[model samples]
Target: MNKKIINKYTSDNQASNLPDYQQCYQHFKWPSVTTQLNIAYQAIDSHLNTSNENKIALRWLGKQNQCVDFTYRDLAEQTSRFASVLNTLGLESGSRIFSLAGRLPLLYIAALGTLKAGCVFTPLFSAFGPEPIRSRMEIGEANVLVTTMSLYRKKVAKWWQELPHLKAILLIDGAGVLDDGCYALSKLMENANAGLPCVKTSPDDMALLHFTSGTTGKPKGVVHVHQAVVAHKSSAYYALDLHATDIYWCTADPGWVTGTTYGIIAPLCLGATMIVDEAEFEVERWYQILDQQQVNVWYSAPTAIRMLMKAGNEIRTKYDLSHLRFIASVGEPLNPEAVVWSERVLGLPFHDNWWQTETGAIMIANYASMPIKPGAMGLPLPGIEAGIVKRTNKESEQATLEVLSEANQIGELALKQGWPSMFRGYLHQNEKYQHCFTQGWYLSGDLAYRDEQGYYWFVGRADDLIKSSGHLIGPFEVESALMEHEDVIEVGVIGIPDDIAGEVVKAYVTLKSGVIPSEQLQKQLKGFARKKLGAAVAPKEIVFRQNLPKTRSGKIMRRLLKARELGLPQGDISTLESDEQ
Candidate 1:
């Protein structure tokens, strides 16, 4: 076997100084599985008759100042009602229902309901504008949609007749009665009272249809099986170290995998209560929620963590956050410096985890209550086999995939093929599905290296490699260099095409509190990064902004920046923010 790509992180794992992180945040320790439903359904069936039925499952807070809570029993009943309602609208097993909402309790009800009743539940970015909403509705063949009346009026009302697949629109509101064109969700729930039965299906049964940003090209549909849901239970509880009673909150919106897995599926599978606040990140409000709610296991992205870091520890210190046990970051890797700052200021090291939409849920992460390294994304979950594929020194192409067996060499991240939660296939795109893997190994289009002790460190994305004037610069290295500065809160380094240098590195930054965007600070940072990283890798330009365009999960959209600069059509502005960047 080609050991270079095979054990990409093994060398780095061996070199890591954090021994505790090596043991607790380890990989490949769980039982093997082949399905998503087996895990989720088992939880529902086994617990349905038990007294644990009344345990709290969800606590939702809408963006418009609304609150609702549910127990397992309530979930069962609501899901059943959701099943009956959707079925009445003529949708059956294998049909599709699209839910367009952030982190609403109803969205969960509709999703689990659709699964039990044998329909594919597809949730899109709730922040997506009308165009994306219409496009997805058409492509997914989604006939039935559940959304608020406002979303209908703002997005779908004008396009209703134009949608050939969309037959009915259900409206949910703070208060409303059931009607023909629009059925009031509250009254509909009152009508369909009892619990619904789950369909007798194997792990291979289609459970969800997720749409991934066709960054490689066009948007494509990804199908996930029933067994994928159950696989997430272990991935969430074990890898995330989430507990049964912990008031957990993973800050991703329902549109993303992180939201569904951590925010809904995993928490419900473990019978843990979750806080679903449909609010964006506001420094004071976030701290207030963490303090007021006494949240225990808190999971957010590194981008958000970096923003909080820039917000200054002084604001966070005012709140009594003693209830929090595990503070974790996902979506993006946490920098070592930010991790140290979190430990020093927040009294906890923010654990990092890694996963892709194609993986269905988290494949690697620092487990709850486990030893953690601030910079590493942690080991693969119990049964996952991950390694690095090195670049060969052939005087020809971009890096060739080298399967590694040792530690400390940079390589393309690859996972052992055939995990239970692995995506079934891209919807209607067989060739595209097979293209993601090679020799039975799923190539995660990311770069990572292993240390002496088995921890995986994230490098930038495959396409994020910066080439400037015959020298290649890794954006993360430059971004990390800038992050060390006290004035810098967050930064994204992009390679802007230039006539002279081929491509010049431009850094877009968001600064810390009390730090004004001045010529003095700009020079100070440029000089600091030149010293930290070599002069060749230092950014040539700095564009300071209050924010950078990021996905709902807190990933900086570098493509958006590149697209805007090239004057190309901007794709997927759902998560982009102009004011932030």
Candidate 2:
């Protein structure tokens, strides 16, 4: 694709007129009927024919300071070998493949190679305990599993027999594995052919399966087709401002949708060099990597940003980050404090975006060329039609939708149904999938409002909204307001049972280091909240905490906190990051 044609689909990095939903779709160049449109082919194989063949595709940094580089040609050959290995195992094209490892080179190979082989690929976060990993593998009906020996022993070996459909287990990191049809990944790759061609599949063919947590019961398995790559490529270009020469770093784990889309697919499809770090989050280490790697674009989560804010600004002076041009945050609503703090300290304010595991790609984002509203989620992507809508009837299963025309009216953020990346279905839950849509729009399950300038402002999850007295309150507003306090490090807000109001706002706070938690300080914080937010909306109860419950992905689990506080069932503690007493 030429620069002009690519920019026609992926909008230019300039504040220009964005095409409508239909126009954006029409601009994309879909593959011919006879041709295969594998994501691996787009990301790796296609680049081999051009000058990008020898370009650095991935730069991996190991825990012990070891480093490795994978060129586009190297990636193509390695992935082909992986695909050939799968073929030798007598596995069918449509089989399900799962990768349950850290951000290692083998895991990346499995992700791309599995898709290139016309198999559906699912990624499980390595931090997940045994139960969570087993549950996801079970739900996805994983046929082939690619993981390290350590993870297999700790997380999979115990329940390996439970999954009857599991065929082969490829140990990517260790030797001496032959039980239960398991084999060494390196040996298999070495023995297999490296000249295997990419599988030919239709646009509607299953490509990826991603699991998202539900408020109750088991996680929902979101299914996406090969056609979704069109959206992934375009969204990355427009939202991230990714260029062929830019070096990018996406800190999200590859198991998450953001990591799969932006971290693996988008950057590579655009021929950008990606930096992958296996080390855990450390403020100084992250800064050093950014400075040393010369990362032009950085994609990360809000929790990491909050952690950096707690690390203080003086530490930043030790490193040079002049090469960093753009930064973005996802996974949750980034509070206004982070935006301002970044601008003051890092010289670049983080642009927050909104999307879901179901959407598969970024739906709304603050463009590099556009003016940013500190807390807004920016405008809808070129191909997305977003609106604030309310269900006509809550009690009915087939409830219809009514789009709210007024600006700043809190309602469910809904999207029109024609986006290429819109999820096809929730696996084995057809009824549940149908419930996600009302009339024509896809109900995002997120409560938000749009201002006159077309910026979407997040409120909170619909079920997470707190009703106190006669007013509807979103926990994010209270939490953001509380975060502005100098002594506050992190905070979570939940609605507790109140005699008169039915429910009242309660705040659990973690103080900054050396900040004493005293009655006088509590009173001071209460007054601070009251000053920022009106009496009715400000937190009525304040409790001290060393930390609050959070998901591994950095989202505060408000429901878990409320459940624990009320002595209720703590459903699914699988993804809990920090369990504070």
Candidate 3:
């Protein structure tokens, strides 16, 4: 077996959506549609009039060994009832409805129903504290909030009155008794008619509002239109290898963009059976679910992969994962070691893909039919045009973007301006939206380089790039190199101010289980990294940490690490999942 490439067509038994990348890319065509297109209609209602209406659309597994299934017909009726309930409340089209709940059946219903009613749906992480929840609700001007009783009392009860635009609070699980403006969704659903027609919405109508936190300012409300479902359906077919009959599991919370795009919309729109787990990450439980559910396609993040790696490979043989055919990773650039480890132990390699909240769908991915390059972000999707470009001018208005022609040259990753899933704008920030575009390309703010074979490799974010002695270095390179060590499980790299070298590379590492941190071990790891990345590019200082700061979406907070190291203010920590002391 070759170490560099994971062959797609290992035998005649293997099958994929795109058997040939170039041929598929050249002949791809989006289906023509009428002017009125509702995402909810595309996902559910269209299936109602077909034989697929009885097929299971969602199979939700509760934390306590409970299972509930909803078919396409069931979902259509339930979501229609919810839409009728919204209409009864006098919430008109385009009303913003925010949901702050876990992986409950009602949350999914509310999301689809909002789109069915032509209202905008926004999801907030259930783990978020009061401040983060309040800030987002205020910014988005949430008109209706759907949540559980405990979440309402703990996070929203105190400040619900503060937001003037908040008209009602719909509790998903509650008895007859309610607050002043609170209504029980169960009772409302019982009374609502299930035959309510889906509102006619134009393709450009806003359907989803997703909040992404920045390093400094407040979270930006990214606006995605209903037309994004086109890209969502197509990308899932090409990127995720999703099919109508496959049982898929996407281990992402609906609050994040990945969960919404892939976890909810893409699967349903493609008529795939989706598995939703209510429990958090547990290695034993994950293995059991994979074995029992017979999940054919799995989508997850790099953080969960590292955690699984940390759990030891011996635990893997305890269960049968033979049903898993395709595995894809997103949320962050997957380290090359994880990809290789998955193939070695799990019998299949993970295909890593790259996209963001702004892009709203997968842009570049290692297709199901393509050979996997362990660390490279594979070719652009069929209708997408991506390039590595540099800005000639600093000013927003006068900036002249030039795509780099040479391979292995680092520059900003830019995409052509008109993908359907591309965010329409940052809700209230027009100037920030305008600044994102230059010369018909959307500047992605991420720095990367393309190899001679047309595979794109991620360097760090432009802001996270380090310059030492006039040499530019990406933290991902150092981190990936260090990850090759046997004992190292996770690594976060940053650049600290240095007297002579301008900015010097520093790394914070977390070792495997039972490995005690010592000066000798630290020195050994430092020597290993230096040997791998050279003296100048390797870390000048190495720190052993128990945990590194990270966002809920599993991205290491490099900016937060730099801020804490320099005693600078830690700004906008609303999306932070964990912190290191």
Candidate 4:
């Protein structure tokens, strides 16, 4: 298969971009490596400090009916003040600060403030339970933390007494009322200088640390530098078709890398407005925002789209969604069915895209004007080079890594290195970091075969594959088949520990609306799967559920499912829903 980007830009340094104020945009100029990260600094000075300061950047809503709007100017001043406090507290550059809070503005403040102060910021999943949260904080060696009063009083309230590395906790809503031991964020910011000087930082300076969802036990910290943000902006602009006038609402939570990239920096870097909602996924509420906010480019996950499809088209048809220009999918690969359903009901094909938390932004995507196939993850964006490598046949007559140059061949997808947003490293884990790459090619654990048309077809994770009766089966293929059943709203397939066939596929499924829980429905669904794909790939066992556990970004936690099935420790339950808990 050929590389994804049809065109490549000559070097102008890796941090280049067209002026945000340009009247007409044509070709994009990628920034050189020597490009200044002061773009973010200047944005704070120009668009934010002027007439648009009153323009809202985020609309945070609460479960208790409280609402708050943060304008760009408000964000700048608050972050600047917090920067002053951070410096005064002896927090130096490179000092890591791990932060968590229920979808709120303080998460943004702490992140930007940490960066403005020349310190690195790490985000922990707000939904993570105590152990997972503590694991990340301890692993990151975060000297300070910023969170809500309730989270501090309930979660970290006991953590401080245990893990001593987290020296300080800054509470957003607990000011004045918080325990004397914990610092009040509002009071500190009030005491700080709003005119605090911005620190001069290199593009390569450690900017953010995100924890990857480890299919294997412990979560690994992925490090991204300040320069990576610029890379994220360039790629996100093209991949997601984000424009200055575009009112983009990225549904990813701040707890994930996509949230920090698209929801925060990418929009600000280009001087575009970003929408933030503090509420959880509610189909009717989501459509209401699309109409009210006029969200132009909608980027969410396949899981969300499926959930939306289940809600039916009545709510979708009610909205005057003429404003929505494009839609895209992430987190998990989008099924062909979801793509078609989105176009029929939402009035547009929800484009499928692929990327990892480590990569920062969309590396491969189906853009607004790009040609899109129903099931294929479209071409790689400009500046990214990819190829498929056939699995090592230990029993091969001749030995070599035969990169597939022909169509209809399945192989491992690997990226050519030196991309700006490529993760710097796994924090505190050198050997572990080295495992994902060979030479410079980042070995994406995903197995995808490239077609002659330059589109990539996803197989499942390298580990999620099951070998049954000596035949290899991708869990996604089986899971997708199961999802076709009307009774199956969600499905997760794993190779159960089996005796004879080496491994047997067992599907854990969630029922859809109007489907009453009964063995008859389960039997019919299993029979349907058998007729659809063949008995070999059909689930040996069918387990029904009220809901499938998912991350805040709407990705089903497959590892969590596998962990639970074998009575093993469920890894990184931080993103697990409260209802699940």
Clashes of each: 47, 0, 0, 12
lDDT of 1 by residue, 219-285 (tens): 5678888778657887777666777778888787777667776777787787777888878878888
Estimate every model's Cα lDDT from 0 to 1. Answer: 0.73, 0.83, 0.87, 0.73
* Index of the highest-TM-score prediction: 3
lDDT of 2 at 107: 92
| lDDT agreement of model 1 with the native | 0.73
Question: How do the residues 268-343 of candidate 4 rate in per-residue lDDT, one tens digit apiece?
Answer: 7666777778888898888988998888988887656777878877878788899998888776667677776776
Per-candidate RMSD vs. true structure?
12.4, 12.1, 11.3, 12.5
Q: Write the per-residue lDDT of candidate 2 for residues 113-143, one digit (tens) a residue.
A: 9988989999977765565567778888999
Off by over 4 Å in 3: 1-19, 32-34, 464-581
Instruction: Write one digit per residue (lDDT tens) for candidate 3, span 1-581.
Output: 34334343233324364458888888876666559999999999999889799999999999999999999999999999999999999999999999999999999999999999999999987866565678789999999999999989877898898899999999999677788999999999999989898999999999999987543456689999999999999999999999998999999898778888998999999999999999988999999999999999999887778778889899999999999999999876777778879988988888999998899999999888876777788889988999999999786458797899899999999999888899999999989889899889999988999987688888867777665543445677678778889999998888887643557899999999999999998899888876555575678899999999999998899999999999999999999986666
Write down the worst ten-residue block by lDDT for model 1.
5-14
Error of 4 at 385 (Å): 0.4
